[model samples]
Target: MSKSGYFVSFEGIDGSGKSTQARLLADHLRAMGRDVVLTREPGGSPGAEDIRKLVLEGDTDRWSPETELLLFTAARRDHLERTVNPALAAGQVVICDRFADSTRLYQGLARADLRGLVDQLHDLVIGQDPDLTVLIDMDPKIGLSRALARGDGEDRFESFGGDMQRRLRQGFLELAREFSERFVTIDGNRPVEDVFADMRDVVGARLP
Candidate 1:
């Protein structure tokens, strides 16, 4: 499990621009001659990508929380084994758009109180956390609105509506506090350049 590379994950509500920021950071790192692998949860490796379709592009009631948790955990295990671990072992920076934290909020709190289950599954299977987690914090209403506007067929989570988003936003903040050692919160309501500037500065300070 020990690796020489840096592992960074971006976490936020559906449309908080975490994905965009993650990509930008990856590009910046690569431009600086750093070896970087940019990937996303539930869909990083081939097997995980297949699982992603089953979980992301369906009705809001596609699966029960417990079932969803199992599916996500399965996808993550594959993702970590095939994608993240290999990249880190090769001494490359692994930039993930969203990681275990998303599941902690979406399944653990948003749908029901499953944090304890989430942790148990994570420790039992995943057994890892990112070296740095950049939380793109933003207003839930705005994030959901932007997410729904994407028309990307990944709106199953956004379909839960504003209330769930509000709860998720608060949940993310609490998580930031809970894992303050590696969690860095950056406001996502600002312009792309402004937000990216902060993100770049934060990561640059921590990069090995």
Candidate 2:
């Protein structure tokens, strides 16, 4: 809830329902007569969308952890420049499905150094952190199973195995601890309507 506008982010492991919650929040705001923009990381802007396909679907045999981090940040930079910044400048609430926090959790904890280059790059890419970040926390096994059941072949990253997904979940918790003021952990295993109700309460209290 900056003077400029709200930059709220939703974070969680795959199949944690972040996208669904983000859309629900945006729709709630719009119904209340507030202008809102709902977008996602790695594939928001056109340039970022192309990069996303390469990062998610392209060959990863040659891709190192650092390379993965760099690609995600590049997409974030483009997304911020093209979509997020413009929407916020126009005083619209920008609800992003994922942001730098995802990079911190995925690359930082699962792939790369949690204390090194990836964290530094995250700081650089997201100069000012999100006004609020709602983390839809859930069991990694459940989340991954849900993702697999949705019928998309495992991408390079998603195919990292169950242990990595568990680590990534811990990584998100670590981030929430560090940024307690901005991070809200929500139990995502509940029914969709119940989760939506909690999300509305959180957003309503913070949004102007």
Best by TM-score: 1
lDDT of 2 by residue, 29-91 (tens): 899999998998887999999888777764546477778788888989899888998888888
Residue 174, candidate 2: C-alpha displacement in angstroms? 1.3
Q: Candidate 1, after superposition: displacement of residue 95 in Å?
A: 0.2
| Per-model CA lDDT versus the true structure | 0.95, 0.83
| Candidate 1 local lDDT, 34-117, one digit each (tens) | 999999987999999999999998998879999999999999999999999999999999999999999999999889899899
- Residue 111 in model 1: lDDT: 98
Best by lDDT: 1
Clash-forming residue pairs, model 1: none
Residue 60, candidate 1: C-alpha displacement in angstroms = 1.2
